[model samples]
Target chain A: MTSPVVEVSHLRKTYPAAKRGGTPKTAVADVSFQVARGEIFGILGPNGAGKTTTVECLAGLRRSDGGTVRVLGQDPQADPLLIREHVGVQLQEAALHDKITVAEALDVFGSFYSERADPAELLDLLDLTAHRHQQFGKLSGGQKQRLSIALALVGKPQVAILDELTTGLDPAARRATWELVERVRDSGVTVLLVTHFMDEAERLCDRLVVIDGGRVVAEGTPSALIEGLEGDRGVRLRFADDGARERATQLLAALAERDADVTAAVPIGDEIEVTGTRKVLFAVVQELAAADVVPDDVRTLERTLEDVFVQVTGREYRVEENEEVAA
Target chain B: MTAVETTGPVRVNHEGLRFRAFWTLFGTELRVWLREPTGVFFALIFPSLLLLGLGLAVPDFSKPMADAPPPWNEAPGITSYLPTIIALAVGTISLTTMPVQFATFREKGILKRLSTTPMPPQNLIGVHMVINVLALIVSAGAAVVGGMVVLGVPFAADPLVVLLVLVLSTTAMFSLGLLVAARAEKGQTASGLGMLIYFPSLMFSGVWVPLSVMPDWMQEIGLYLPLGAAAQGLTMGWFGNEGFPLAQVLVLAVWTLVLFPLGVKLFRWT
Candidate 1:
């Protein structure tokens, strides 16, 4: 890839003690990632997983305790102003003035940069044209989110950092935001998305890093990560009769004993479940055909990103909420 | 999907962009402040209204003072309170309007949000200061005009001295208010702290009792505080032929020099 647009190495950040003599809290332990130009790169983690801190370091809003961050070929710590000029950010809890109208917010923010996107075009793209004159306080949650997104894009930034962009949005709105992000990427801006939603990452991110406890657990495309969990795929088989079920079980057990690809064959009530690698279905059907014993039906279990997370982290994926204190 | 063409990044002159951002932000913030009628009323109109009301309604208000000195004896009773009302106007905006707005913006993350952009969030403080100072001038002007037109009060004997004192006193009061706005985490706390300072300063400014009638010790202490110094200096320049109250001017100058840098140091942008 042509030189990466963003690069971070061993980023570590710790918030100072809230009170005197109190122990400092570590927000980011060690994180490293890169985003190429024109790609949707995701930083996926649970609440308080240092996702915000990592992105804040990239935006030059926060300085890292230890490590290096380079955006658009400049060190963020040394040249924060230049970094801010080129990168657009939509912070999670940041809000506009209550009395500021949609158009006014866009207009004021747009004026901050030298090259800016057309405010009218941005408003139309985010579906906020009808509410352009509406006060920020009067808009619904989704509308506010869309307006924030519009503001982020108003500067025609080369990179956009969106934190929890669709957290409070409805299903339809969430889908719409995903499409908007994709469109933004297609138009040539790199996007760095921070989210805990597996589906959102799977749908939008061309590549992503799964961070837990301030460490990267996995990094790859959604499908590639899921495909990494080999030997977990299985097939459930039903038979025409009890005799056929017994024969199939014995045959699958023999195959499991001899074939390296077959992990186990277990019987569930009147059916048999054959567990093995991705080719388990073909292996089982071949074994059954050789014996001339056919099953009534067959079903394959599908592996999703959720299962991938559980396997990789060795813990159930549960959204630990309210842990972040807005650092 | 409709194709939204992306524009290429262009190199911008930082100084030029910051200059533009400051002016744009000033205009936008001023509009937001104006939309809140309570702030505008207290800062701009209330001072003159209070002056007119007291001048017309109080018994023997416009009648010449029956005190001991020539210039003092010639002026009306209401004229003695003119400086106090002007000081109160500055206090209203400095303590109540400005701090509350700053704290509310911090609480709402408006300042924090601005930090992410190329525009420095400190510009908000400068913008607010300009707006509040302008309001101060307008209110001070109205009170002086209203006093002369409706109450038959005489104009300041030393116009240049009055102007200088107004500048010093406004800066002093605003600096004090800036100290309160610096670290207040909540709007309620800011207003509370502002009021705590506000009422006592009003007392020292002789809002409740004319400084001439206040006890010697009280008057001594009043001259040291910003509003009190402002009131005493303004009164001397307005009715008296004295060049200026050097002591009161020194006091205000000291307050401004000390409080402004301290406020900026303690400021919490987030």
Candidate 2:
């Protein structure tokens, strides 16, 4: 494959102390990832997880204390003008003048680029044509988000960095924004998505890096990350009584001893929980059928990206922390 | 990408691109400024309106001063107030309009957003300066022309000298205003700080009490401040035959020299 469109390796950034004699804070410790062309690459992390810092470095808005970042084979800090011309950034909490109309905002930003996308086409794609004349301050939250996306693509940028693009949108609006993002990617623009939403990452990212405490804890496609969890799948079976449960436990123990897929079989209350590989469910049922032992009810647990995130970060995802740490 | 292929036809003229971006932002900002009634009224029309109001309201406002030097004594009293009004025009735009606009842009993250583009946020500051300076010129011109037609005020003895003084005065006042804008966190704070400095500037420029009537010690101090020096320099250029107002011009030059670079150094993009 050709070199990735965006390359970042061992990236580190530290914010100076806000006051004299205060200790400096490290926002990004060691983040390394490469985004291939035409892929929706995601930087997934909880609040204060350095996702914003990573993209800010990639956009040349912030200087990393260590490591290196190259967008379209140009160093962001060294060739910031060229990088800015080619990389469209949708920064979180960044807004246009309140009085600027939607179309005016797009036009002004488009004027900054040598090659511009058709504003009418972009507005249609983002479903913002009806609100083209609305002032920025008057637009609804979803409309504002969509306009931001439109501005990001108005330059016909080769790489677009969208930071928390759908953070405040409702479910329907978020879905629409996601579709617009997909369309942008399909139009030959490589997208670097920074988000704390696991579902967004799972649904949109071709590959993502899970960042925690300023470091990449896990990196893979959403399904691969979920599968990377060791013995994460399981089967739960409830029995009529403890007598049947005990018999089932013995049979499952025997199964576990013989089969490599059965990692564990533990009894909780009247239900015996079997934890193992994806095929463990079928293997456990076969073992029970051989003994003519039946389960009252059975359910299989499927791991999701959320579970993978929790497993990798060793903490629940908290979105309310307000990631203003970089400021 | 398609952009790369299209780039072949579009020659890499970096300077030309930057100039185009500048004019685009400049036009947009000028429109935004004009749309706001308060900004346009205060910056563009208030000085002339104040002149017209004072000319009509105050009795014997057009009479020649009884105790003034030479040709200036022969000129109408309203003409003596012209310098102060010109200073007021530059002061209002610089302190009240420019600083608040800049601080609010920073507060609202407009500057930060612009910084992500090829054109830096400093371009916006430069645009603000150009627009505000133009407002100052228009306001000063309106006041002078209005004074001539309504209050029988005479034109400056040397229009060139008056323009030179206005330029120096504008530079000094704008530098001071930019210093306030450099670090203010909010529009409210900037306006508050602006007013704090603005009232004192008007006082020193003798807006209420003519500098000629002030005690020698008071006038000495007033000559040192930017607007005060501006008022004195403008007065000298308008009516004085005692040669150029080198001392007042030097005072304004010092103010610009000290404050402009300091403001530029202290300014923050985000």
Candidate 3:
């Protein structure tokens, strides 16, 4: 059997507590997973979920207290030098010296590898050719992120790891970055992406592992997880007036009685959202038709990955911690 | 062009990884130092100013005894002060610049980023040391020239002795700076603590006052300090004096040998 591009087993990391702390913090605990060659494997989690810690261990930046991590079939801890040749890493807060020009930084990083991709080509790929002579500090936030990806690709690594690739990007730039990631994967490099954004995972990841409280909570394709939660599907109905809303509410109540699985009827804005399984949803629609309670808009939508996450983990998709969002 | 072979023939190599890593870090240090005029001014100009200011302000006591002879009469006072000024300057740059640079690099996540690469931590420190040593030599030369021009100080005819003294003194100061830089948690703390060491060394090593005039016990204690030994060696070299104390050389050497490895061991990349 062919070996996986990346393999981790029983990885653990614990840090000593600070003064006035109750107990030591376990950043990661016995986490294990494997990524097939040329596939985009994502790590999805909330803040403080140990996603970054796990990736750091895989990158050989932080030493794990226990367990084995192998990248490209070489031990990251024992053979970090060998592993680095095949793996490119773009850390969340990593940056170059402010005064260093983009081209110079690329050249300098390129020199670290025995075989390197053409700097000009990389710059063009990341849409940074125009900023080749500009200083690193002078670049915009999106430009800097792109330049970082260029640096990582310079080595022509077989495996690339990206942490928070598009956390602060606007929608347009985020879409561009997603396309860039797909291009990177198409070049035959396996990708290990770490992000908290469920939309990003659903759009880009072939498969993903959800981490919470320093352990794996779930692992599967985005479609599979959403499919698993389809039984709890819901329909949102919008009405033109309060009278229409009242009529829809009475119709939903009757539908709930007919279908035992119709768990809740929620009122949102000028609409009443009905939630239940496929069978329950069908019964609700039939009952509404029988009552002639035709609403302004009625749409059936399956549970998204976000909804599945909320149901299983009992937490919403928290894109920002309070401190980070304030900053 | 011959079909630019881009397939299996193209393989990542690690043959020159060590050299490449070292040079990249070394270039980074030099580039940053060159770009910052304030840093260059303090590292180079401050020592020159201290040497000229103190040498001219103080009396020339190289003449024969008026009151049982000034203790520094055996050597030209300016010459004695010159080495201490150089040592202090070397210490200032290494301790002040290195730790601050390291701390800022850590705070900026540059060190953490570099750690993900194939480069070892030793290469990072080695590059910093190399760049610092080069800067130290350049600053020390300027100080010597400044002393000669401003204070009319004479050079030792024995080039070998001068070189030896500079080497030993630089080694000692560099080790001390490394120790401070490695231990300090923050840039401000490193700079403040380094200055704490710098002021005392300047006072006790006879950079500001003649060590010979100090009490006999004070002189004995100063002999053990690397800065004092360096100052004395430079004095002996510049005046072309014989009977330069071997103990001073030994003391500086011992400090270099002991502190350097300890500094490296304690150093934090992040």
Which has the greatest DockQ?
2
A100-178 per-residue lDDT for model 1 (tens digits): 8999899899888887899888988899999999989899888999898888888888899999999988999899999
Clash totals in order: 0, 0, 0
Off by over 4 Å in 2: A231-302, A320-323, B1-11, B67-75
lDDT of each: 0.87, 0.86, 0.76
Using lDDT as the measure, name the better of candidate 1 and candidate 3. Answer: 1
Query: For residues B1-270, could you state the per-residue lDDT of candidate 1 as single tens digits?
Result: 111234323346678777988899899888878888888899999989988998999977878988736766767789888888999998999999989989988988888888888777888888998999889989999999999888988788788777888899989989889899999988999999999999999999988888768898998998899999998898888876555699999999999999999998998998
- Per-residue lDDT of model 2, residues A1-327, tens digit only: 467788899999999997999998899999999888899999988889899988888898888899988777778766566677778888787577778889888988998888899999999998989999988889988999889888888878888999999988899999988998999999988899999998999999999999988999999999888877864478999988778888999999888888999998988877889988789999999999989888899998767787887787677777755456845
What interface-residue Cα RMSD does candidate 3 give after superposition?
8.6
Span of 10 residues, lowest total lDDT, candidate 3 chain B:
B1-10
Q: Which stretches of candidate 3 lie over 4 Å from their true place?
A: A16-24, A168-172, A279-292, A299-302, A314-327, B1-17, B52-80, B210-218
Task: Assess the local accuracy of residue B103 in candidate 2 as a C-alpha lDDT between 0 and 100.
Answer: 94
What is the lDDT for A73 in model 3? 65
Across residues B1-270, which tens digit of lDDT does each residue of candidate 2 receive? 222222212223488888988999999888877878988999989999988998888886777877767756777788878888999999999899988999999898888888787778989999988998888879998999999998889899878878898999999989999999999989999999999999989988878887667778877898898998898889888886758989999999999999999999998778
Give the alpha carbon lDDT tens digit for every residue of B24-76 in model 3. Answer: 76786578668777777777678888777777776763333333333434435
Write out the backbone clash pairs for model 3: none
Interface RMSD per candidate: 7.1, 4.8, 8.6
- Chain B structural similarity as TM-score, candidate 3: 0.81
lDDT ranking from best candidate downward: 1, 2, 3
- Could you give candidate 3's per-residue lDDT for residues A1-327 as a string of tens digits? 556777888899887765476577887877889888889999988877888889888887778999998777667777566677668999887567787888888887787777789998999889999999998889988888999888888988888999998978899999999999999999888899999898999999999988877788778998998787644677888877888689879878776776687967888877777888676667767877888877788888655678877777777767553222100
lDDT of 2 at B71: 59
